[model samples]
Target chain A: MSEPAGMIHWEAQDSIGILTLDAPRGNFLSDPEFIAPEQLKDLLDQDGAKALVICGAGKHFSGGARLDDLFKLAANPVHLAERMNKGKSLLDFIENLDIPVIAVINGICFGGGLEIALACHIRICSEKALFAFPECNHSLMPGMGGTIRLPGKISWASSLETILGGDMLNAQEALNMKIVDEVLPQEAGMEKALLLAKKMTKDRPRKVIRYILQALRNYKSMPLAEAMKEETRMFCELAYEEMERRKNENLL
Target chain B: MKTSFKTLSVTYDDGLVHLEINQPPSNRMNSLFFNELSSLVDELCKKDGISAIVISGKGRHFSSGADLDDLLQKAVHPEKELSSSGTFSFFERNHFSFLYFEELNIPVISAIRGVCLGSAMELALFSHFRFCSEDAVMGLPESTFNLIPGIGGTSHLIKLAGLAKGLELVLHGEMFSAADALQYGIVDKILPRKEVVPFALEFAKKISVNYYKEKKTLYLNSAA
Candidate 1:
């Protein structure tokens, strides 16, 4: 893959796709004003991608929802309702993408900005970065599913406190909370992440990865027995898929 | 309608109806309390000359959470569920009451002290502004109950602190200090518990003056 001209920059190396959220100047948002979710989904779905790195082009990653756009939505209730559905669809796409995605946090991580990254499997952030999810103060919740997903990654108690208190933490704090995986210098975050991505892709079982991802996503709200059933079903499926892959390799 | 007041106390002071919790040390929530609160805000949103609303608590702590005591009560008295009429459901009450701070032509400010937890956090969140004492240790612990913030905690906390910080609190249910509250823009100030009452009154009075101005202008326009 190669870079596009305007909205956002897309590139690929070692089968690891890189998306630069330049237009929104941070983590690109799902809005009419900037890189729409459809455009991003299209890029992600394109063939020949193994892993991906997402970073912002400007000084910040993103501030979350375009408040100006949100205000417009708030003013027009019908329109807000329609657009919110679109937003949820986009979030599903980010979460379900087949390849492992990593967020390269360069600066401030906020609102939807933090949310967009949370969809990815891996997160590499700059040590100097500041991150926050200040949605409650606006009298609005994370419409894009932050409430459900974040609690699973961190403790449920932490997620509740964050959503209610609305306090931002630094990169070190985020690392301690296990919110982000690794923290590097602002300038080195991308390079190190790309290196890690390349390492991850080697000898990786893509099928196992996808199944585990789906299993986790599927069992989120279900009872323990149901979740166990799902896990067993997925584990058998993974075994079958691995056997099929081995046979294909032998034939080749 | 006769209210079965077992959770909170509704009182009147200086032309404003004050809603204060009586459950002492920590006014943990009960269904009865939520039911009455929903009804009170509904009834009071109408009525005459109630120009201001102040939500506070008795004793040291504001509110702890869904009273485990109350939850156990519900398990026993499952038939006592309230049929809320002309009232926004629990979540809606948390959301719109803050709007009511401005909408009902009154300024509402919650004077929070000691430990404010779970739905109590929502109270601070929706109050348009919050006044907390330096001794207060506040946070949202709903996740421990195997739930997300249903009462506008997510929406309000995110706007108050920003997304990352918001995520942190909701994820951990960690308590924050008055200084941290100030740092995160959670509280307007950190005052001695002794000063909280007077400070809130004066602050409420100051904002009341502005509300009067805006209210008059709207009336003149509508009447014209």
Candidate 2:
């Protein structure tokens, strides 16, 4: 079925929903004044949508945040503060999706473009993909939780190196660092991402899947006791469901 | 026994800090190594009479990059895994302590031998200068596993090589020799194993004098 068009495009092909982002060229994020986090929530919450594949529309996935929008936000200091937190909250929406969110990053990905991919559970970038943070060089800081999430996903040394120095990297370099799953031919990145989404999503258990992901995400951030508690709860829930199935089969 | 927070070791003589990858056996980089080296550099920055810093490793392998054991541990028990900020593992928080090295006000150089991969290469990238022996192998191998170069490898790799070559390295996890490293800007110099330490020391002193000379301008300005 055809997906609706918006700032970030959405479509479902082969039962895998694809989210294509094409704002002003460079994938600059839309101005918050016209469409803030509300637009992103609407896209994610769209009914009948299961898995999401996020990719870029043009040559570069996201050159970075529309710095023009940043300057405008600075102009309206009070209103900007009100709008800023939503960016991070929106990231959580992506992270906590009932279904998986995969990123197929092709061409140049910088700043927000890259951060958008980091929100996805799986990332498949192309060899052509070039990424950079450049926030420090721009005399600004990373918003949209890049510092918190990238470091958590990659490593502290890598995160600081990119943040402190404004160096950019191509897809191959990203692959070695576990930045992307594979560096495929640019044409095949999205195809592979969709294939992965289908394979993982078929006959999947939503609650169990979410819990498993939550366990992985929270383990490193939380203390051992808390992580164990969450894991035990998940185990019990899954076990009880298994026992019920056994009873139905008259094996108990 | 006191854990001396050291992934690599060094000694001071001949007006040089000869750093060695002190991890016994293979000298594989793991969580403890990152933590030890970072803290050691932090402490070293405060000490006096330190002329230069040169990092090397023991055994045949300089470093096998991110320890596969570390990877297996994290993969099997995701629950026991560590976040970069978490204090559970020093290896987990491999932030570039080159800032601390910068604080030391001395030149830093790495004397490479054997294999340097993944986060191990990330450490070498930070040094303003590096010496690789004939047997040195360096690369970022994150893709072989289902991951990306998490540490500063991505940023540093591109800085040393152009975007095009960096792409080739990142995507392929291709291991290059010390000669190629020099051409790719991965290492500043290439020498035999016996001369690697001496070369690094000489390189460090050369740069150290320049560091002191550059800072002397501030001192003169203050006095004036």
Candidate 3:
């Protein structure tokens, strides 16, 4: 009922919730506007929220974590570890969400920005978008779950090149690597994300949508036999739910 | 190593082995196909001369995957399914056999063309690299028939393609193009139909030689 907290600007239109990273130029992640765990969880938990789209307010998705913040954390090792864990936890929460989460990338997406996009369920990018783990240039690695998630999106060899080389990937190159699901002309990234979200959730009830998303998460981590059995169980459960819903509607 | 098999033909060239699925009319995996495949891989594991292994199909297809008729028959007689875990299991020792490609330190390249579906797709997923012809078709079509991928197709695909797209590919049960396969990280390269084998060989040789050189360097560096 109340607006979600944090620097994220949350608004619902046509049953889709959009979270704009409302920060200054480059949308540096360490800015005060960064979405906290509680804030994000609150936004996603809202009722009637069919799908969520995360995007930047200005030219860049993010310049990634701030250098000043990194320097400050380096001076306090314990605080640094806790901050790293929190970032990882946020990505994990986004990944395990029971509804679709899409990242609409524009302009510069570097380091933590790229990690955030990778953690989402799907990624869409603008033609002018540039992606890289500039962390290597800063003499650090992507500590916010990028290294483990990168290999799953692209080839292991290419993942190394992207992370270690600190090279930039244009939109087409990202598409070739399958790092992003779709690449649209500049400024069309948000429209494409909305269309895809709409198509995915079309004619499906909230429960069915959630079930599909939850069941999919199992395929990634569960054993083959276990995942198969879980899939069958979900199928049968959905079947029963559909039957029950039909019966109730007829009775009404 | 014994070279004769009813379902496959093995040819050794220099340090590379070309293993072909020879069943006519789309090499379908039946009982004999599994037996031959299991024995061939086991033997190849012991052979010292091989530097890389290349797998392809004899006819138009890399494989049409499991024979539905054979699978149905076995399903009807579930008691025949072997089990080492004290449970009725279809993929008992066969699970290990399918995963053997990954266990090999040497490179395993799947030169895929035509239809690579069902269990065949699972087999390709275990290969270190997959090279396909432009006209190649690939997918895991089991979910369409009310069954899930039995032999690690779900996990391997999720590893190659991200979790969301991987689930969509299997859940939708749609066959895709070699280009789509490459985009999904399922195949490493797409070449002309006539060139798939040659490209696979070249890739295998390059990686195999580089692997040995890297190993020697690591050894020397560690010793120093």
Candidate 4:
């Protein structure tokens, strides 16, 4: 079954949740609060998905947030703040998901669209993909977590230049800067993304995947000693479960 | 100033301090190497007029990493040798010694050539910048020996490369080429074998004055 929430179309394929940006042509984001964070969370929880892939419906991934819509929202300060907060929260939830989230990007991915891509755990883009943070040209910075996440993904110098210079980057340049993991042919992005998703999650139990992802996430948030302790605890738990499973099998 | 060392050779030119691993023919870091490193770092910490530091190997290779025989002996014997404080273990003391390079205010550059593995790679990872020769072979091979990188290699690898690639490299314990190392973000640049040290020295001289004030990429892109 497929469901549409705002501009996003959510569907499940072989236990992989696929979220497609459904706006045709440019896929211009008309609103910051396009999908409610709670609504998306509920969908993910009920889907029993092992992995998630985010892509656009048509040629372009996204032309980014519509400047006209943003200008209109800026007039009402309270409304704009609320909507931006919702958008930020949505990205945050996606980043913190235990299941791996892959962004299969094609063509243009700029501004807010780039921010959405940054939230994913892995990014695979087409050779024709072009990226930029054009907010600087519009006399504004990225309102969503772009300022924080881009540096974490790439070098601080490169991220600063990318955001402030407002220059367009080809897929090769982006790859060179370590912004995206891999770049395939124009039409091979989705296929590669699915294969990668399957390779990472196929036959892997949900609990094991969750534990591994949680440990990896903890490395970023906690101190080295604390994270190592957490890893040791998780390792012991998995070992104990394995021992019990082996014992039961032997008895049978 | 003391001019000689058992495991390391220290030389100064203007404001740049050149620290070379003296044990030649695949300089394997033994206990003496770690002790010498700790004292050298302490000396550099106390000395003045040190604008930048460059580390390299004496002969063909940077290092073959920690001597496994020495490491295994210490592991099996479970030595009671603790730090002066009597609280920290031998591993923790060595970890802190490696970490001191990263904490230095000046830019620390590594000129790597030929093989650099295990704890040697970990030391390069802690440097501000690493310039490798085309033939440089690097990896953390402790996993193959039923061990893991003890002195912050795993964490630093993850920081340089992402979590997925880092975990894969450590688990597989495979040697990667200089090109692959550059792709993994482990090394900043790859140059010819002879140019590696000269370029690193030139780079250190060029950026030492405004290291913290200016962007690193600017100097990296500038001609050496």
Among the numbered candidates, top lDDT falls to: 4
Q: What TM-scores do the predictions have? A: 0.50, 0.50, 0.63, 0.63
Each candidate's number of clashing pairs is: 48, 22, 0, 0
lDDT of 1 by residue, A171-209 (tens): 998887878877888788888877766654534555543
Model 3 agreement with the true structure over A1-252: per-residue lDDT tens digits: 222244467887777889887665687766322566677767666736678888988888877888887888779888778778877877888788776888999999988889888988888899999999988887899888999999977899999999999999999999888898888888898998787676656445666566556556776668765665555445444434443444566731
Task: Give the per-residue lDDT of model 1 (tens digit) for B1-224.
Answer: 53547767876666666678778877877766766776776777667766566677888888886664333222211123244421113334434444455445566768887888877887767665577898988887543332345454654675567444554465445678888888877877677898776666666665565475335435323322
**Which regions of candidate 2 are displaced past 4 Å?**
A1-6, A32-49, A250-252, B1-224
Residue A22, candidate 2: alpha-carbon lDDT: 73
Listed in order, the DockQ scores are 0.01, 0.02, 0.07, 0.06
Q: How displaced is residue B152 in candidate 1, in Å? A: 1.0
Q: On lDDT, who's better, 3 or 4?
A: 4
Q: Evaluate candidate 2 and give its CAPRI docking class based on DockQ.
A: incorrect
TM-score for candidate 1, please give it.
Answer: 0.50
**Candidate 4 chain B, which ten residues in sequence have the lowest lDDT sum?**
B76-85
Candidate 2 per-residue lDDT over residues B1-224, each given as its tens digit: 12354566656676676767877666887767766777676666566777777777777766877675453333322343345443223323354463344335666667788888876787777665667889888887654442445444554576567433564565446689888887876776677788877666665666565566345335323322
Q: Which order, best to worst by TM-score?
A: 3, 4, 2, 1
Error of 3 at A224 (Å): 12
